[model samples]
Target: MMRDQAESLRNMVKKNRSVDFQVISITSGKGGVGKTSFTVNLAYILQKMGKNVLILDADLALANVDIVLNEKPKYNLLHLLTGEKNINEIIWSSKYGIKFIPAASGFEELANLPKEQQMFILNSLQDIYYSFDIMLIDTSAGISESVINFCLAADKTVVVTTPDPTAVADSYAICRIISNYNTGNMELGLVVNMTDNEKEAERIYNATNNVIRKFSGKTIKYYGCIRKDEKLSKSIRERFVLTSRYPNSKYSQDLEIVAKAILEGNLPEKKENFWRRILNNWINLKFD
Candidate 1:
């Protein structure tokens, strides 16, 4: 890890960097809906839109964002937890200039940290959080504490689901959890991935919102759907981003539309800055 370079970033972040950062957690009710893929591609698009974007790989168990991007981070959250790396040291950037922090399965060990180490973490990350216009958290599937905490903390959470019945049910489950837990008017958006057509995706989005309103008394915004393209699976297997490998594919084109909506739609009332909320992990709650 280049301590000098990372240390310089820490110093630079404090020179009047605004805290108006948007923390959006892209999560799903279940796995296999292409949630991480969407997060990675969206980061690419957001950066291309001239926004400083960072993807926080919050998938605790099966983190494949690195695999999807074809870039392996030298240090990760585990290293920071173990005092082997600082918060800035763990961040890795793709060749495409997409920055991300990969979380190892071993980050499960964070629940048992001592006070000194916990404070060390909070102090270290405060400088780095403002370095991005947006921070995209690719949360793990299901209603795990990590997933719920991230969703609850974010200014917005976009739940990605497919038109499948089971996926729709799980999407409702996630919406319910966030609705019950969130204290503010945190925006919730829906994206139907892998659909064959927009009509099917819209139908699924409406059905999912109907269930949310009936049970949770809240509704989610409909971000446009991303249809599955033939090149999607091929790019994944080849460890290349769909946007870079096949920019003309259906998936990339659909993502650009969603990215536009996300930019226009996600202006939630700001609360505590995201890093402060993360600091709460060791102070008030434990994600593990």
Candidate 2:
């Protein structure tokens, strides 16, 4: 029975290839919850597991994932949105085998793009969307219209929160907001960041789930939790992804599990695409 269920899950992921290409938007109710860190490391982890991943610096207000990787992007999502550059022209390969489209900086007006421009941006983004297996967007924190629009467009929405009471409360609020637009079977995952242990993370997840269940009759499943660690900050200071620079580190190990969970959710059948494998191998070798 367990094997049959696993096989069924894998088949479902294999058959449901749609547009927007599995946008996993990582957002937090408030800032400083390690949202960007989670996004960067998670993208790296997915790449390590042989998946073609694209990390978009969707946090237009304060884009820093490129900086965290100690990289200086030539172009950003804002440039793509404004027709300043093409998508392929702006994408740069990270050393960790993940391709990134950096968000253009110094754009206070980026969040308020006009409707026609917004549609154009979306269409341009969709043009090369299927080129990768996963498109992860590290969105700006908080419940702004920009954040809501990104979440709604994504197939999976991941909300990051810590073990703080206020953080938990805000997470519930975010979940309620997403629930309003999610009609049926859109997978929403939670990442409990900066926790002491799995028990603490589960406690936080349960607490937020309780609030969501009572208030909105919805349940937010956890993708995974990232433990609070000094090495994470240390790696940031060193200007490298923890998974690539410090694979033996605890944070790297946890991120590996998180990556596996994400892959399990998305590619349950474990069928390998020959072209993707060949392409990703070539890309990884070049970047490495």
* Best model per lDDT: 1
TM-scores of the models, in the order given: 0.85, 0.82
- Which residue pairs of candidate 1 clash? none
Tens digits of per-residue lDDT, candidate 2, 133-248, equal: 88888988889766766675565778999888888788888888877755434567788877899999988888877877787788777778888888988887888788787888
What would the per-residue lDDT of candidate 1 be over residues 35-97, giving only the tens digit for each residue? Answer: 888999999989889999988887744667898898878887778877888788899999988
**Regions more than 4 Å wrong, model 1:** 1-17, 105-123, 268-271, 276-288
Clashes of 2: 3
Candidate 2 residue 43 C-alpha distance from true site, Å: 0.9
